[model samples]
Target: MSGHSRLVELVPLYALDALDPSEAASLESHLEDCEACRAELDVHRNVAAQLVPDEPPAIHVWDRIEAAISQGDEGEVIDFGAERARRRGNPFNWMLATAAVVALVFAGVLVGQRLAFDGLSTDEGVVAAAESAAEEPGALVGDFLVDDVAVARVVLSKDGLGYVIPTDALDTLDPSRTYQLWVLTPDEVAISAGVLGADPGPATFTWKGDIAGFALTREVAGGVVSSAGDVVSVILDT
Candidate 1:
């Protein structure tokens, strides 16, 4: 039989230094030319290293391991792979596997939290702007919709300050274009609030005077003084 067929279980045992000297010597010889076994050995070795603590576990730990092995079967073959797959699983290895899975899950949660809150300061500003505008005495709060789909919320304070809170809809903007917010008056006049990046999150603008509502238009980067492109979305105060 080829090396892997014979040494599949032995490789993992050898990685843990649990194999006898003779068995280890034999496995080391096979490892010299068997790339597949070497890779598998490395994987098992890494997992074992990560699970083992720097400080030795209590004496009861050895007792539990002994009891687990004895319960598995004193006369059974010492094949780690077969033992893992056996009908009556070894509790010791199962505990180790569970611990490894928990460690991996905890690590993944930490990474996800880091990515989710990396822009905490910016998000704080968005929430603060929205709350502040909402609390203003005569703030006009309205939603900007496209094709009957709400994409952004516009808040206009009585002091002529405006804030735009973008939604998931802005994700569809073309990378080559910028979105510009305009304050439209009753006589059909549009005033530019400011030009925004393609996928802006939240923005604040100043409109000294306003009459009707707001409109969003797509324009080239470094937005024009006046919009000449098709309007993407509109919000009417009425």
Candidate 2:
């Protein structure tokens, strides 16, 4: 008497060995070929494995085949049903709860930012951000992801004076070459800050110079670029 049988219908009989020998054999054969049955069996086995005993038994857990066979045979069904209902309510609603929490946090940050600049005008946020950027040892060396896109975080230094971090877009590079950062000014251009490519902080160097131009362009090893890439992050501080 079957159209499409529920997996739940099979559970009690499966737990009790209630089926005849022929029926059990048929079910076993079908289970071997069925992904759904195997997955369901795996979950039940995992849950059963977690059941604890208030008083330990010396008997081997696997030796008790009756444990599974005794499944739908008792008042224990009520407890399993309650646990299943709680699990369903707990996991799915969590996504909605998390979304609401994130929205509240983002709104709070926006309000705080507005309150901070209630008196300042004309791009005060930009000014405050830049000043905050300067105070950060890493921000002044804005050599990381640009405009939310992934790129190389290059660091160049020589002779121990220190180096500069340049955020150079990697998509602009070719297969065999790399971009290099050049330190130049209105009157002089002298240090090769570094060669780009590689992430997680490029090799640190002992660099020394006034980094005026701070341009990045494609070049050969020991990088030499005639014109920098279009995605240049120029700082005209000089």
Best by lDDT, which number? 1
Give the range of the ten consecutive residues with the poorest summed lDDT in model 2.
99-108
Backbone clashes in model 1, listed as residue pairs: none
Q: Please give, for residues 20-138, the per-residue lDDT of candidate 2 as tens digits.
A: 76665455555645677656656765666567456766577755446633642441221212333365543212222222111001122222232121222234444344333333332
Q: Which residue ranges in model 2 land beyond 4 Å of their true spot?
A: 1-140, 143-160, 163-169, 186-190, 197-201, 225-231
For all candidates, what are the clash counts? 0, 8
